[model samples]
Target: MSAQHFVFLLVKNHTHLTLACATEPLRIANMISGQELYRWSYASEDGVSATASNGSVTLVQHGFGALPPCERLFVIPGLGMTDFITAPLLACLRRAKAGGVAVGALCSGAWILAEAGFLDGMKAAIHWEYHDAFAERFPDVALVRSVFVADERHITASGGTATADLMLHLIEQDHGYDLSIAVSDMMVYAGAREATGEQRISLQSRHGMRNPHVARAIAIMRGALEEPVPPGSIAEDLGISVRQLERLFGRYFNTSPSRYYMELRLDRARNLLLQTEMSVSEIAVACGFQSLGHFARLYRKHFGGPPSSQRGRIA
Candidate 1:
């Protein structure tokens, strides 16, 4: 069979782990199969080279102006992805999609796809840290909690090792389960997660949060970040007394339920502040604060800086 080709557009500050995870699977597939099952190439926005977040540099085989033909074109982006969403990049992607190339994204690259209008009404996944801001910015896109989404024409992985999982899924589809499993064995990637596997650990498992009621309460708190529910209401929903909820919070967080809820909202506010272009006042309102002054004061107290000071995007 003919080799399936893949092209990756590497934006600056892209995470090296996901990039490696994306390509290494293909390499292993070829090694195990003893044939060129897959071919891959790299491109950069400038047609020169791009630097990863960890300071490693990668020279590219092409640039946007000269992207080679491929079966799949994946955008591999990292921090500050919004800044790199330029006309040229979007146009290149649009042309590829228009010409029937399957476009995909890795890591926060889904943000780029959303910006280019590729993921509207599509099931997509992105790195969990960017969920709140991404949801706020692109309401039309249906973002799933899964590590990857593969059934759509525009594929996406939530980054990190999830890229490997997506690649393995493709290998299994094109070749067979045996070759994919061999590739995984060759790479020591046992038990790669399926497409529907969640990106985060259950709240009940992480950070010693063993109490189911507390976990349920935290889930409600996260969902209501934009319009926080009252502690009494959360307790009632959990079928427990308000004082019982407070005790649970004290046991796990050593704080009042209200204080823990405040921290959750502040954390969301911080994510929006750093990952989005939303103004402090808008973020304040988005995080359920009625008064900008109050938001700023609490933000400063919780984060050791005013919301404005958190303006810079992640690098």
Candidate 2:
């Protein structure tokens, strides 16, 4: 078999720590093996360079326009993907797929893959904050909320240590536990988890709301995505009046029910913009906004950009 060539599809201002966690284990595995089982190059839309969110510059040798065939391609991205899917990068990923590269995403990179239209109907994982919004955006893609999901081959992982876990899983798959163990020992990763590991918290428990009505209402809202009911309708279903719903939201969130729901819808819009290559009109409809102009207006008010600009930034 040929030596595995791993390539990273990075964007400007990707998270530096994630880049390291994604690549270093492979470097270590090569060191421990005394032979090159994996080799990699960095790629971006252009052949220029990228700065991590923390302000580190990484030089890129290849533009997506000139990338070589590779066994795997991983996209590493940082914040603001909700507004940054550039067409050039999206096309690059699409071309890579047409060339038969196995692709994966990390950190906010899942948003990029979704933007490339690569993650539809697949199960994936991503950072926790974007989970609700991601689900709302890509109804076809199942957001697993795991640290990593390997079965779909559209593998993704939450950032930080989860990035390390993903690289470890790759090492294990290619080189076996001996090399994975050596690299893990070198990295002092006794606490590292496998690809099949679940995310740390349950959704209900994370909310810390013992109040059954609020919990049930959240579930109802989550279920009724295509036809979102107002908090009043949800309240009625929960056996509470709208005034009672207002009190519950105020007590727990310090916000009114209407504002909270709006936030939820807009948040979903943001995720759809980042993760799927769907057009602005498509995303708007998916987020339950009947009017494209209204969706764009609310998106700007909340996230400070129109849908077109947001998608451009992620690329």
Candidate 3:
């Protein structure tokens, strides 16, 4: 079979994990199959290098001014994605689509594709962290909460290991199940996750709480992490008395509503500390803790270290 060429357009601060997961599958497939089944290259805006969120850099072989024809062109973006979606980037994607190339996005790369109008009127997936903002920005795009979306013309993955799932699906589509499985085994990947798999764990799965009211309450808390609603207000919204809500929480979670809310916010703060470059104070405010001193105390108690220390370890 002829090699199916894939070109990845790397934007500044692209997620390193997503880029590796997207390309490594193809490389392993070729090794396992003993054929040049896939060919890939990287591109940037001006033939320069692109840096990832983790501070690593990738050198590009092509620029938007000289995009190579390929079976697919993926826009791989990460932090500050809005700043990278310049007019030239959008035009390059548009031109690729017009020239009959399949256009795709990995992670926040969907933001650029949507800006280029490629995802308009189509179902798409992006990194869960960007979902709320992406939905607000691209109202015309039907955003799904899946790990990835493989629509007829537009392909998208929610980033991270989900990019591997998308690539395995494509391998299965092109070759067969056995070869895809072989490639997955070679990479020690736990088989292929369906495109329909969710990017975020459901509340019930996360907390093992099954009661309907408890589930609804937890969902509300997650949605309002930055500005938590009072427990009484949550009970009121659910048309239940505060006592009933408290009983439900104690029954399922064995904790008070306010405590549970604090845990949720703390969990989010921990993730931001590890995965993003947000300052401790900024993360505290974003996670609904107004007092920096108070936030530091709670964070140390919960995570066994200060938020700044966690960020330092990650760095």
Candidate 4:
């Protein structure tokens, strides 16, 4: 079989270590085998040298202006992608997609790609810290906070070690298990994980409320974020008085139930703004607001801007 090939896209303020974690495995795999199992080159926008978040810079072999044909093009943008989404970059991505270049992303690069209209209707895994914003802005794109995604032609992943895992999966796919294991052993990785390993913190523990009643109430509230139930109703359904409900929230979270519910709605709204392409009116309606004016006012009061403006700046 021919050697697997890739083109890695780097950007300013990228996580340099993550880049090494991703590409070094391929190098090790090639070293282990007697043939060229993998080959790759680095590329950047405008063909300029790319810098990492930690102040290191690397000169690439070619710029996005004149990329070499490769099996895959993995975009590895990091912080400040909100500023990185330019007409030229987006046009380059569009051209690449049109030219049949299989595309992928890492870290906030997913945000950049979606802004360039590459991720519509596709399920993506992105850095969890950006999930709220990503999901909020790109509702059409299914957002899974996992290590990586490889179900179809695209292969986006979250941050840091997730990049390593994605590369290991690629190695395993190109070579067999033995070569993959050898490469993994060369790096001293504990072991290769199945693709579904956890990417973000699990919800079962975030609640910290072992009381089933409180858990049920919180879950219900999360599910019904748009049309929030009155805290009193929640207490009543949980077979507790309003005072008791207040005591539970106070004990567990040091806050009021109404406040908790309000925060949850706003949080959901924030995510919609950053991740989905839904209009502000649509997001407000989905989050349970009947009055667009009221939703905009409240959103401004909570997040320092109206929903539309926030999504515009971020997405």
Once superposed on the true structure, which residue ranges of model 3 sit more than 4 Å away at CA?
210-213, 216-246, 253-315
Best by lDDT: 1
TM-scores of the models, in the order given: 0.94, 0.68, 0.74, 0.75
Error of 2 at 213 (Å): 15
Evaluate residue 64 in candidate 4 and report its C-alpha lDDT on the 0 to 100 scale: 71
Q: Which residue segments of model 1 deviate by more than 4 Å?
A: none
By TM-score, who's the top model here?
1
Candidate 3 structure lDDT: 0.87
- lDDT digits (tens) for residues 57-124 of candidate 3: 88889988789879999999888787777877888888998899999999988888888777789999
Q: How many backbone clashes does candidate 4 have?
A: 23
The list of candidate 2 runs beyond 4 A from truth reads 201-315
RMSD of 3: 5.8
Query: Clash totals for all models, in order?
Result: 0, 11, 0, 23
Q: Give the RMSD in angstroms, all C-alphas superposed, for model 4.
A: 4.6
Ranking by TM-score: 1, 4, 3, 2
Which tens-of-lDDT digit does each residue in 150-264 have in candidate 4? 8856778887888888888887876678888888888899756666877855455776547776777887898688688888789889998989888888988889888878778
What is the alpha-carbon lDDT for the whole of candidate 1? 0.92
* Candidates' RMSD to native: 1.7, 5.9, 5.8, 4.6
lDDT values, one for every candidate: 0.92, 0.80, 0.87, 0.79
